[model samples]
Target: MGKNLLFIALIILSGCKGISQEEKKEDKDTKEIAYAVSKTDAEWRAELTDMEYYVLRKAATENAFTSDLLDNKEKGTYVCAACATPLFRSENKFKSGTGWPSFDKEIEGNVAYDVDYKIGYPRTEEHCATCGGHLGHVFNDGPRETTGKRHCINGVALDFIPDSK
Candidate 1:
């Protein structure tokens, strides 16, 4: 009976081992995909501000209605703070009232999407295609008159460039 119990425990442990191995394989696969503006951890830490590093590098969220960009109405382009990649244009900006800066569309190929399970469910996470900096999440609840997609972005992850007249 003791031998049988030990065999059963070993089988259960082996079954669990495959899950972590598969997860590690998936993580490695993701890391293999190169970005345009890659940087070492020290470089990124030195370049970005505290909030910017937290949101862009660590995928942290800012408080609602706390971003100055949320109320911005000027014509400009929003670029990635880490890589200066043009992400969203002023024309695409909208009032989603979710407190973060909301955009209806993104400059194509500037943003990448990944499935994030941080909130206990799968959310479409947006990142800068150039630097792989975390931008925010995209949702389906947007203006019906447009693409019906909301690119909910973190203000700290972006840098706004006003169009020169």
Candidate 2:
């Protein structure tokens, strides 16, 4: 019966090790990141609407073709809804027909990026550099004459400021 008891001990030990590793990974993922426009969860909730909170803080995507900015042709700057940081210019905007607003490029130094595997594959996730709010994704399918990069942004994440004439 000694062999049986040893096997049981090994199984328990292996299980515990697995749990410890999992916990470490979880902790790493949820670790706090301080941003230039840092705020508590309660503060963010108080300031943002439900949809804004979901899209900016929780990194949720809005439905395609639902953004009022999709057909916007006015000259202006698109800023981050959460922080008002200028993200995209009207000059860089294009009708990508991808439902969401597309930009050929972002206001350089205002956007940040990271890799996320939430969909089981790698995608470049963009964020507002000032507040760390989720903006959207950048893809390679864009005008080759320009940046050749498609900044497929969620409309909910942006606020348009029409240029004063």
Candidate 3:
């Protein structure tokens, strides 16, 4: 009887441990950190379209091959749509066949990364450093000639600025 009670207590404690860990993670994710550009949730929603708000603020993904920028080949810099911070340069862009704007590298210091487990596995999620807007993910499969990193960015998260002749 004592052993049975101890076993049940142990099981309950382990379940509580998992819940506490999940709560800690939620708290960490919700803690606000100061960025170069910060806005209230209402302001962000008012400024961005529904899709943009979903992808940038809520970390939702757009459908592959649905971005207007997927086929863009013009020379320019890609800036964060939320904060207009320069992210990837045209020279770093490449055809990754992933239906998203792929860059071998980002303009230094403009992007930040965090681990995302939304899909049941860990992925490196990139975002604009200035406004903390979700941009996309980074993968290791990329051109060997450069950084060997594929920065797969969301079109709705970026705005292209054509280079002057």
Candidate 4:
């Protein structure tokens, strides 16, 4: 009975993987998790630009102040570049001076959350619910007048849609 129990414990432990959200390159043996709009890695690479693929699929951060949409003040919506899932509204966007597009809130139910320790500290990682594309991280230091949650997003992971005139 003792040997049997030891074998069972070893089997269980062997099947478990670290929960940290590492880049796909680090764990090429694992399968991608399912999402509402899943696609093959080749399809994603063919669809997105190099930068977009890095930010959305590989979970990389873009350089600060490098996004064209950082200063966008027009009324519109921001959708996931990978899957076109609405993620944030223009009204929620604010100039946090973080050099990337910042928002106080997300379009409810359109975003998903996961905890990642890729930076040596646990941070709330956000993704597009439809395609599971990495959007960015959320912080607590935000305007107290509104949601008080600062969603620091990667501009390359999102596309803007101006309100129809």
Candidate 5:
């Protein structure tokens, strides 16, 4: 079932034609920015794992507790799985006990948010500003004295490289 849905999404997105970076813009009132990716589903699937494709392409949620990134204590940047765009800094990662990898903030404006109606509730969907890979959702219920924004991310959407030296 999930595979079928992913194929449909791929077909729809593939037919969108080519979009250039210079044409990318956000609606003044909506604040929604269009993400342009030039990769096809076959190319993306060949490059990413099933779990990564599930989240990045199909928007399917993975078992938070089962993800390895949640327990990862490495010191490095978490980059986008699709395009290798630097999305989250290692300093912002925190164990929010939400099962998934959580972050207080992104590296400056690397993350973008929009309304996601996939699930019944009106949630804030976050994506990578570089390749527009779906990171996760942002919640208002976060730790105090910080940005107060809990970036609930899918572990498969990221690749952590431990810092050396």
Candidate 6:
């Protein structure tokens, strides 16, 4: 009788051990938890030009007066550089006179806000929620009727598409 009881306990423990192992295997097969674009750094460098890399990865700001899209009147979507996700639309863009690509709003729920202490004053900075790439900064001082916000984006983080006539 004692031998039978010990054997039963061993069987139960083995079954539990198998289940745990299976769960771990499933977890290993799953994707990473972070919201980063799937492409590697090398892939991004290959896709974008040198200037684009300077702004997107190195956080280098482009000249506001030189960006061709600041006064652009065309309609199209703005996509992410690292992941190519649709972020902003032409409709949201406006001339904020701040020398950056200004957007009155984002593409709804895609913008994630974080405290940017880079300047040492805790300003609000935005990033791609899908790939965790930096986009630009947000300010409360904007058009009073429209979204009550200003999304000052770096032109390097975006690829503009012109609308078809």
C-alpha lDDT score of every prediction, in listed order:
0.89, 0.89, 0.90, 0.91, 0.80, 0.75
lDDT of 6: 0.75
lDDT of 5 by residue, 52-162 (tens): 888887777888698888988878988888887788888888889999999998877777777765554467888778766778999987778889989999998988877
Q: How far out, in Å, is residue 121 in model 1?
A: 1.1
Best of the two (2, 4) by lDDT? 4
Poorest lDDT segment (10 consecutive residues) of candidate 5: 20-29
Model 3: residue 140 alpha-carbon error in angstroms:
0.3
> Tens-digit lDDT track for model 2 on 4-106?
9999999998777543254222221476666899998899999998888999989899999999999999999999999999999999999899999999999
What candidate 6 gets wrong by more than 4 Å, as runs, is 1-33
Evaluate residue 54 in candidate 2 and report its C-alpha lDDT on the 0 to 100 scale: 95
Quote the lDDT for 124 in model 3. Answer: 92
Model 3: lowest-lDDT 10 consecutive positions: 19-28
Each candidate: RMSD to true structure?
A: 5.6, 6.5, 4.8, 8.8, 13.4, 14.3
Which clashing pairs does model 6 show? 35-130, 36-131, 37-131
- Model 3, runs deviating above 4 Å: 1-28
lDDT of 3 by residue, 1-165 (tens): 999999999999877754325532432166776898999999999999999999999998899999988888999999999989999999999999999999999999999888877775668999999999999999999999888999999999999999973
Per-model TM values vs. the true structure: 0.82, 0.81, 0.82, 0.81, 0.75, 0.71
Model 3 score (lDDT): 0.90
Model 2 worst lDDT run, 10 consecutive residues: 19-28
Q: Who wins the TM-score comparison?
A: 3
Runs of candidate 2 with Cα error greater than 4 angstroms are 1-28
TM-score between candidate 6 and the true structure: 0.71
Question: Which of the predicted structures, 2 or 3, would earn the higher lDDT when compared with the native?
Answer: 3
- 1-165 per-residue lDDT for model 6 (tens digits): 999999999999777754325423222114454665656679767877887777776566777767766777789988777677778899888889998889988987676767655553556877777766678889997778888789998877887766672
Candidate 4 lDDT (Cα, 0 to 1): 0.91
Stretches off by above 4 angstroms in model 4 are 1-32
